[model samples]
Target: MYSVVILANGLFPSTEKPLELLSQADKVVCCDGAAAKLLMWGREPDLIVGDMDSLSDSLKKRYSNIIKKCDGQEDNDLSKAFRSCLDYHPSSIHILGATGIREDHTLANVSLLAEYTELLKDIDCTVDIMTDSGVFYSGFESMQSYECKEGAEVSIFAFDNTLKMTCEGLKYQTDHVIFDSLWKASLNMAKSSKFVLKLNHPAKVIVFICND
Candidate 1:
């Protein structure tokens, strides 16, 4: 399968898992300032995408051939890089450097995972946001199972507070809980090697599983 990795302008990953994935990606796409980070790490980006506002003139001139300038106010640089990845028709897309440093940007990028899931569902492409702490996945309201290490941290978030859900293999049961607040069902732990989530209706939800 064609796998693509997108590096954003957030904190550059220094952890082992994110770094390994970045180094192993078939194609590494950078978003404006992230191009400089990739180069400093001794790896060249296959494609640099953004509005060109964050990049320096010398770096732009040096990598002009590989840069894709997307000047639009509607989407951020990370979004532009993701849209560009669609042209490659990759089977899977992994996003890194999308969290930390700025709290606002981190939250926005995390929420975009849900939007990306909606956009790529029909195309059968998997998208994930990998952070220094964990990995983020967006899915619809359904019975979803995730294989993870025992005692791993798990958190679920949804835009609709009325949405009810249940889970198996979690330290705390979620059947009787109302998701009125974003932190209502956070900081959960897995009791087994895998956990299952059963949603009450068809709605989008974001799940985060920390690295083992």
Candidate 2:
């Protein structure tokens, strides 16, 4: 079973209502004081992980199974949790509460996505971060959108070189077009209520270089 990981938010936003679907996860992990937020939501955090900075004493006492303590200022609790993931080897990792804070810290957390490729090696892995700007990630050809509104927008750039794209139903469709290797990613609009993108040629390619 995969584990849903929640990172300590320097600042929690009011718009995020992720708990509405929290029950879908097989297990829950709190990266530091983020455990308190889950506790406040009437949800029991399976594990309270990370250094004990923001995590209160009570939280530590209540859930000790996942309450892993790693003291370090060089990295945030999110980083610690990623390292700790190796021990459990969760099949899937869903990250919530990983947005808003010091711009640098937020950048650091986003940059952590790259370091995780080592963990993602030879495994199907993805990271989800909820933010006002919206969700982002790479990998996974068939993305099942849980909540993309009629007018809500999302943009995906090829991580490395441009991909040979065959968009199914976008406002501007591409039919086996070779997108550039080192160029801007084309902004495609959704045409049908739901859409899927399948890369043409090289059906078995993984790990792309992205500079967007």
| Each prediction's number of clashing residue pairs | 0, 4
Model 1 C-alpha lDDT per residue in residues 118-146, reported as the tens digit of each score: 89978978999999899999887477778
lDDT of 2: 0.56
For candidate 1, the lDDT comes to 0.91
Report the Cα lDDT for residue 73, model 2: 77
Structural similarity to truth (TM-score) of each candidate: 0.96, 0.63
Q: After superposition on all CA atoms, how large is the RMSD of candidate 1?
A: 1.1
How well does candidate 1 score on lDDT at residue 160?
83
TM-score of 1: 0.96
What is the C-alpha lDDT profile of model 2 across 81-158, one tens digit per residue?
776665666766756666676777666665566556445767665555544445544443333232244433444444
